[model samples]
Target: MRTDLCGRLGSGDAGRAVTVCGWVDRRREHSEHLAFIDLRDHSGVLQCVVDGARDLRSEYVVRIIGTVTLRPEGTANPALATGEIELQDCEVELLSRAEPPPFPLDERTDVDETLRLRHRYVDLRKSRMQRNLRARAALNRAIRRAMDAQGFVEVETPMLIASTPEGARDFVVPSRKEPGSFYALPQSPQIFKQLTMVGGVDRYYQIARCLRDEDLRADRQFEFSQLDVEASFATRDDVLGFVTRAVAEATVAVAGHDPGTFDRMTWHDAMERYGSDKPDTRFGMELAELTPVFADTEARVFQAPCVKGICLMGGAETLPRSRVDELVATCQRWGAKGLAWMRVVAAGTGGSALDAGVAKFLSAAEGAAVIDALDASPGDMVFLVADERPLVRHVLGLLRLELGRPPVNDGRFNYLWVVDFPLFEALNAEGEPIPSHHPFTMPHEDDLPVLMSGQPLDGEALLGLRSQAYDLVLNGWELGSGSVRIHRRDIQQRIFEVLGIAPDDAQERFGFLLDAFRYGAPPHAGFAVGLDRLGALLVGEENIREVIAFPKTQSGADPLTDAPSPIADTHLQELGLRVLPPA
Candidate 1:
């Protein structure tokens, strides 16, 4: 180790003798008496001129003592941080010699992901991974600071807790002490944070680790982190304010700008206008209702349950006839009966220019109505889907994205809140209801009487009930959600009744939490932000794996350690466990 990092050296250190240590990025031999080596550390790379023997190779960890000097005229590397100066008269001491990397250490192209993961220790040496992980750490620190400033106390929740078969499948741990029993990992600190509120910790937070035994995607991992928070006697606005402050802090720390006041949209508005709970309000092509436009039409299909369309300006030229067929096939795959489309042709005629798809199903007047309703201009393309309202939204939503409708960046953060979601969805004909957020979420005040009425709800009535829940969405990704909790036992019991969880079953599954409520649970609310997703967003990475230091593959395998491997028989026997042979 020397007096400076290889990257931090500059012309200001000229005529100064300094020591630097790092891996040799590259070595160039001009002559036997003079050779140059690019020295690299976490900070960056520096060029070193050694007027002696040249034995350096890539990844050879070395220390150098040399005098910094201005580079010869016309020899400056404007691309490098230390380009203006080079270390001369260097004495090199090899600390470690590294074998040639399996993949080039400086490669910028795609490498086999599995291979890179297997050699993850080597893969982490790349500059991109370094920057990503660094940004994550800095963002985490920023989150902690924000929580601290907000008078929140960080608390640790249990890793081995009782399993609540409510949300995602849990990764269970066999309890040797209790022979056939098991402890499940926490998916979120949901229960414990609420318990903290019951224990009178008015404001609480935790940078908690969570696990879920679910299918993996780019944005999901079996084990992830979140900023868990809970507060007693807090209103919906209070929780939103807290989240905004923390999110702003994290975003500014990484992106170098504060996302001004986040926009708000009701869940109904999001779904109606953009066809998603987390709408990407970045660009156009908003979904338009064509129900009224076709209500009086003789076309049976077009006048049916619901009709929605999107106008793709200039899409007629950009997207070909084949693309329309592909899009229609995609919609059908998503359960749509069929996809309807019309490409507008610019003509100096006295009638409509609708050229294809269901154009035959409409009169010139109906076609004109469709054109004016979607605001279609010359050469524009209109795509429509008809079915049940939800299916219509779902199909058009998928088509909108397929047509390149997504988040619009306004040179800043597109932070937003989606609120007033349905409290329950129909589970089945057995009369069981699925709580949209969870069983304990407080129903909207206006819907309180509906819940208290004791009248069994079915279909639309159940779906129409809204909850106090809110989700923080950024660029179409749902960052996190929170809601006011039902502090009263009666309201909680009503929810349990709706979910078909009898008093006995409720006590058996959530006995501890319910028992805690018996001791006067306070009116509390909370939110947990997916730290991985937040970090990925701040770093502008679509996949959360990029920001994670050691991310699992989509298959949930740890390539580096080859984890989830078979355990020793003796070890399994200690816990009275055995691995069954594959069928």
Candidate 2:
């Protein structure tokens, strides 16, 4: 409906007649006969010199036929894309007018999220939202282009399928024709894409929709999208290479640079060094093992299975005793027995002088060893956790991140591939060790005998068996995970048996998948990247909701339309369902 977008016009278009249509972003009046109106559209805003009226208000949708002219010497808006030019000789036609918005649209200011969400249409009119959504579109296009170049065949997967109660709760749909039967929305396209590999679709990809009935967080939504992928006759490295190329292309489309080859680490090393499988390697006060240093200590508290410490650089004199106590409380809340600490004061007789009240508990030898172990300097303090190895690492890991957050907007990316995850992990209240990633993940080649022929599949035995699964982590967030599939029938069944899934139950749950294996399922592997989460990071948004157009609130309600409202009784009856009374 217009010759050019509002912001797309510039000095190059000078002397050319153009018809621009957009909302009136801002209007300033010099007199009753002259005014300046910043007309805005998706492209951006163009300043229009209106000679007729001062009645034009913000958000008045208008069409203007005018000649582009350079702005006067001192009036050019250098801050804008169309800053150097202005529209003159304008004939304005108001197509629509709007009431004052509930909140400012042109300038970014804090607005209540609930109010903004309820009027998301108005909120999206802002420049920030427009940029976020546009970046997402670019990201998807880049991913598709890269994958297409790599010989992947895009395929759509089923949304309505039988419930496979493996991970998060599913959003189920009542099967009206079948009475009590229901079709659950896919938590992922995991099974369907794997089946595609078996069906002879050598390479598959989809920008797939997924639903999970789980608690919402800042980076999560009830409905999300994943770059679902699968491939036949592919090794773990083969899939990783393809995924890396696609992700680099997408990130480049958004950030204008490749992230280079990601650094790799084993799951064992990740936990020990950073205390997280998806460690944020951007900054380092890397975890230090003090267990060896305190082995022969006289202090009873330091006689635990593990002693891990992190040197809090420049935190010794900065954190007051009260704050230190609060940090100790925080550690206890995270399941630590108690947080032990030592302030690394001036260099002393052997290592470093201790200052904290509890430092008296340690002998001279023990204190010196602690300082040396952590490489403590004058401006450092050592915080230690002593307990079972797992809990100690867990506490120190949490504390490390709390203390040393990465610098904001450092223009650095830390992409890590964490491999060699245990095939099974012990559960505190479980009957048997469960699959660490998924039941179908192939056991590592070296651990195949431990899985297939171990006398007893005890917790210890299960822990020794590693999986061929790998996770892609970026800036401490687990972007996604992929694994080589167990295409062998015997191996798949053995894994099910080890997880305590009875033969009958296994058939009832994954019968189709196991049956597919019987029909020559080729070896396959794939990974899925969270589009919302990844896009948010790429665009420098902390909350994933910023990248989503119509996101639900944390409570999972659509304020705009008041979705998840009550359904009509007639419709429920037609579907043979009844709403139960609230507990």
Candidate 3:
């Protein structure tokens, strides 16, 4: 419809007659006779000179035929890519007219999210949204290319499938034909991709759409996409390599630089050191052990089984007493009995010393030891939690991030492979160990005897068993997880037994998968990367919705379409369903 894009004309195109189409971004009147129009398309905005009689307004779709010429001296806009050139002698053809936008279209305005989502079609026209969507597209393209280069065959999986337990509620589709039967939307292609490995597809990949009936958060939604991959005859390292190469390529395509290599940390170490399986190693307010220092203390508060603290550099100068009190309350809310705080101040000897209302509770030696253990310097603040080991890690871990974690943009990429996850997260009410990843995850080779042993496995023994599972974490976000599959029927059955799933229950839940293995299943492993989270991180968006085209609000409501609306009784009857009144 046009000879060139509005933003594509440059100084080299000077004296060339061109027809460009775009929406008027901004209009500036030079005098009674002349005006400047910033015409915009997806490429960018371009300056166009037109007669004031044209009455071009913001968001007016227009096509123009003009000669591209260098901008007049002292009038060039250095901010724009086409700053050096302007379209002159223009004839404008008005295509579509728009009312004044409900809100500003520029990034400077922080529009209410609900209002923006209500007019998402219009909101997507802003440059930031355009850039984010394009970056996501580029990331997807790069991932596909890298996977193909590594001999993976792209495959499509079913959207509506039978859903077994996957740790999240499923969005089920009722079948009219069967009346009472339902098909659950996939939370992931976890089973289908694994089945592909059993079907002899050596390598398979899919950018699968997944749906989950879970509460929405900044990084989550009812529906999302994952780069799902599975391979037969592959070890855990082999699968990690496949995903790393693809992720590195995608990162380079969107971030413009290789993140280099990912570092490895055991799940146990992550929980102990940073209090999270997905640790953000970008900054240095790490948790410090203080249990030994207080073991012989007379202070009752410091005599707990575990004691840990985090040193916030310069926190003493910034955090007032009221703020420290708030932090203590927050820790109590997070399941701690209480949080202890100490301010590091100059001592009488000119060394660091603790100063707080609670400082008198500790002896001078105890105070000096606390300072030494935390590497406390003057102007530093120390937060300590003394409780059970797990609670201490949990409280201090969150405190560390709350005090020192940088904004997502300032925190550079620090990819980590968290491995050696325990086979069971914990024991259930019946004292049976809960599966960490899944029943199919292979036990560590050395731990096979513990699983196969005829001895009764108690909670401690079960919790100590390690799985061959691994998770890929980026900047404290868990991107995805995978594990080496247990192909042997005996091993799979043994895991099921340990989890208290009787033979009949195991057959009922995963009989198809087990049956498929009987036909000959090769050893396999796989991983999935959340595309929304990855795209958001790459583009410096804190929320995944920024990179999505039409995302539901945090409440899972779509203001644009007003979805989750009512259905007619007639249609409900046809579907053999009835809506009940709210309780």
Estimate TM-scores for all models. Answer: 0.96, 0.97, 0.98
Q: Which stretches of candidate 1 lie above 4 Å from their native place?
A: 347-352, 405-412
Per-candidate RMSD, Å: 1.8, 1.6, 1.3
Assess candidate 1 and give its TM-score to the true structure: 0.96
Count clashing residue pairs in model 1: 2
Instruction: For residues 1-583, write the lDDT of model 2, one tens digit per residue.
Output: 7899998998999999999999999888888788999999999999999974647888989999999999888988889999999999999998997899888885558888899899999999988899999999999999999999999999998889999888899999999999899999999999999999999999999999999999999889999999988989999999999999999999899988789998999999999998888898998888898899888888888899999989888888798889999999999999999999888888645446777756999988778777777888876878989999989988888998899867524677778999989997765367688788899999999999877884676677777789999999888878898999999988987888788889999989899988887888899998898989888888878788899999999999999999889999999999999999999
Q: What lDDT, from 0 to 1, does candidate 3 have?
A: 0.91
**Model 1: per-residue lDDT, tens digit, 1-583?**
6899877888999999999998888889888888889998888899999864668888999999999999999999999999999998899999999998888877567888888889888888788888888998988899999999999999999999988888899999999887778999999989999999999999999999999999999889999999998999899889999989999998999888888898999999999998888887776788998898887879877867899999999988898888888888999999998889988886577544798777887888878877888889888899988788989998888788778644332444688899888898556677566888988899998999998899987767877899999999988788999999999998999888878899999999888899999998989999989989988877777789888888899989998998879888887888888888899
The best-first sequence of candidates by TM-score reads: 3, 2, 1
Ranking by lDDT: 3, 2, 1
Worst 10 residues of 2 by lDDT: 348-357
Clashes of each: 2, 0, 0
Local accuracy by lDDT, each model: 0.88, 0.89, 0.91
Better of 1 and 3 by lDDT: 3
**TM-score result, candidate 3:** 0.98
